[model samples]
Target: MRQGTLCLLFSLLLLTPRVQAEEAAPSGKTAPFSLSAGSQISELQQQLKESERQRDELSKQLQTASNEHETALLGRLRQENQRLKLQLKEARATATPRLLTDQQQWFVIGGGVTLLAALCGILASGGHRKRRQWLN
Candidate 1:
């Protein structure tokens, strides 16, 4: 009985076409029968081109928005720089130019005082050669 059933099953398998054997899927749907390689490549190329175009458009929109934002910021910065420059110019113009700084004036007064003291000491010593003795 087993030998008879195996023989029958082998005969049925030989009678069916190999291509038609895979026609029906487990889901009961008939898959594509004849898809050429060239058609699949062209379909993929079309999808790629559409995706690239969308990406370019999105990038352009992002760049335009950023440029507008930067333009406004640049204008504000320029205005601030101009205002600061004017303030600096006004400050410089209002300040007085001095012939000498406070430190230099103090040095000049000290030198004059030192010179006056040296002259007074020389005059007070008198022109006596005996008083000019180095040993004393």
Candidate 2:
């Protein structure tokens, strides 16, 4: 038991030096801090703050520009909508029977396509059930 305890202690001491050497080897060199280092840090902090203020001002300007652009776009859209409304009113006042007939024809075609799709779906579902029963 005594020999075992000594061996354990000896192994631990040898391992500690290896671990410490590994840690030191990666660092390569060590630097010591002085009062000027603190001053340099303070200077850097001030410069960072000034840069942040400039960035914030630039951001505000960008936002103002975007807002102006959006307002102009909305104004243009309003004008276009008013113009279209006037044109639509004029067209409605002068619409002919031929135009009305064409509109009705398009509506009937759309309805016919919908009815055909519904019939196809019903037939496909019926076929699927018979196939499933046969497989089972």
Candidate 3:
């Protein structure tokens, strides 16, 4: 609002002098115009100070908001980091364990293989065989 008003004041200040010089306005009108000019100058200075003050306030708020945003992001990242760590721990816990010693593990594996071989042999031997009549 102040900016527009200042622009209009500047335009009028420039144009008014030209108009008065051409028309030769009376001295009474000149005094009022000069008084209004001085008032407008003071008003413009006040508005400038107000604008500077507002700009400073806005800058402070922006700084505060940025700090808060950074803090929030940091907190979320920490939470995610903790969650991932927990997931890793749980996954490791679910992984296969070497509960049995190396020697016991080998023994179990050998026994299983032997048992399977024996089963196969037994099944093969159970099949009927053709006998020669003369040999019988």
Best by lDDT: 3
**Candidate 3, poorest ten consecutive residues by summed lDDT:** 24-33
**Of the pair 1 and 3, which is ahead by TM-score?**
1
Quote the lDDT for 33 in model 1.
48
RMSD per model, one decimal? 15.8, 16.5, 14.7
Instruction: Estimate the TM-score of every prediction.
Output: 0.47, 0.50, 0.45
- Tens digit of per-residue lDDT, candidate 1, span 48-81: 9999999999999999999999999999999999
The models' CA-based lDDT, in order, is 0.89, 0.89, 0.92
Instruction: Show how many residue pairs clash in every candidate, following the order shown.
Output: 0, 0, 0
Colliding residue pairs in candidate 2: none
In terms of lDDT, model 3 sits at 0.92
lDDT by residue for model 2 (13-37), tens: 9899788777443476656668899
Candidate 3 lDDT for residue 117: 100
Cand. 1 TM to true fold: 0.47
Off by over 4 Å in 2: 1-32, 98-100, 103-136
Candidate achieving the largest TM-score: 2
